[model samples]
Target: MTLTSQLTVGVAAFDRYLAICHPHKYALVITRSTSNIMCILPWILPTYVILGPMLGWRNWYPGIPCSFDIIFPKSLRATAYIIVYIVSIITAILYLPVLKTAWRYYQRMNKYQQNQTRDHMQTTNKMKKAILGAKVTGIVTIAFSIFWLPYMTLSSWIMVSPTAKSKLESDLANWLVFFGASNSIVNPIIYAWKRPDVNQQFKKVFCGSKPVSHVEHIKT
Candidate 1:
């Protein structure tokens, strides 16, 4: 929940980067109304995709999956689980490429190999908050893979299987779920502590001062 909201906020920051920091193309490509629509997509899509679907799907299937209503009948919850799992799988596929590309950019930048001039290096440094961003993203994916993915898969099997899960196994999962949900809060905290520029920009952007404009890429 918080993770979705924060990602939406992060996208807003990205839009600001493109508009203020990359004004040349931004000027050519986006009018204020179009920019407004672009900015809304992150928040709007999730609301429609994740939240809306879940709520609406509950009418068809009387239970919510892996959520508070998991205590409902097996048949009801099973359908809900399938719905949620499909959505989660789609989420993973979309983000996997994003994460891979960010990692490559991070490695290339840190290696000092991206056709850098002095001014170019400075601009890249400022714009690429993505190393830390990628870390956060990777961590979320890992958590999803570990905590949710297998559970969803197994539960699908459980939907059919007569063999019941032992108390120890279910207990362990219940205990670990909090750690999985911690990803959202953890990302900001880790970035703030480890990345000085991100911390500064974060304070500048949200703490009353005008945020620094997104920097243009420098020509060599």
Candidate 2:
């Protein structure tokens, strides 16, 4: 589930990159079918990693039920972490151009704001929203990195340095695992904090607010 979440976030970042960097081609490239495929691919790609032990690609540790430590070899586990880091790097790369473009748009909007017509105002409003959305996504990405990096680094260390494994390290790894899992809990809060629509729906569902009609909008 964590792997799927990370990959889905990466896909979302990529989607925003396209929307901000290549607005003209984004509509044609990111259709309904394309969106479906993007959604499915994240889940599908992680399945193999999750199911590798059951599929006999790796052996589980004896007397330790379903532990990640011995499920895959040290080399394979290290490789998986490398893949995850690559995804993180790529997500960061995609955001750079988006931030640049958003800043440029903001400057242009501000320059014309005093004499702006209705159409320009609307465009400025959209640019503001887009900038907010990008910041929200960036926050989520940073949160993922904060929560997962310690666990990944520790786990990789344990795998690579078998002699360094000790009760202290094991306990630390366990705590870090929980810390990483907390990202799942943090994500919805992040979304609600930055997104008014999501915040409103959260209130309506959890706080017994009245139903409000809203058109669904994807930030990116």
Candidate 3:
């Protein structure tokens, strides 16, 4: 589930990159059917990876109770880690150009805002919102990396040195696994913090009162 969330985030960043960097091409290429496929791909891909061993495609360690522990053979586990890290790296790389383009657009908009008409101002505001959306995704990506890296690194170490596993090490790995899973909880909070509509809705639900003032909506 965590991996699926991460993959979905990558898909979102790709969508924003297309919309902001290559608007004309994006308009031509991204249709309703294409959007639905993109939404489903993340879930399907991760499910297949997670279920491969259970489905008898890969060997699992016998006599080990199913948990977060390394249950797969060393080679298969290593291959899975390699693929995950490579995809994560590529996703991070893709965000770089998207953020750069957003920042450049922001600066350009700010420079011209003083002389712009109402319609242009609206366009400028839309660009500012897009930039904010990009920043939110960047922050989420950073959070995901921070939360998951310790477990990934420790797991890689264990894979390299099977004999190094001990009670203390096992406890630490379990803690890190829980910590990584907490990223899913943090994700919604991050979105709520950055998005005014979500924030207002949260307030209404939890506080049972209208907000004192309307917060400008920041689309994410």
lDDT of 2 by residue, 111-205 (tens): 87689888866655666666666788899999999999899888877777749689899889989989999999999999877787787777889
Q: Tell me the lDDT of candidate 3.
A: 0.75
Model 3 regions more than 4 Å off: 52-70, 162-164, 200-215
Show model 1 residue runs off by greater than 4 Å. Answer: 1-132, 147-154, 163-170, 193-195, 201-220
Worst 10 residues of 3 by lDDT: 211-220
Number of backbone clashes in candidate 3: 0
Name the top lDDT candidate: 2
* lDDT scores in order: 0.53, 0.80, 0.75
Ranking by lDDT: 2, 3, 1
- Model 3 clash pairs are none
Candidate 1 has its poorest 10 consecutive residues by lDDT at 211-220
Residue-level lDDT for 46 in candidate 2: 67
- Please give the lDDT score at residue 134 for candidate 2: 73
Candidates 2 and 3: which is better by TM-score? 2
Write candidate 1's Cα lDDT for 24-131 as tens digits: 675666778877876675566446545643665544454544543343457655655655555455555556555565556668777986578998776565446534
Candidate 3 residues 1-220, lDDT tens each? 6567677778877877777777668767789998999899878856776787667664557886665444456776676678668768877888888878877886876687578988876666666666667778778888988998898898899878849588888899889989999998998989877867567777889988675432256543
TM-scores vs. true structure, each candidate: 0.45, 0.85, 0.80
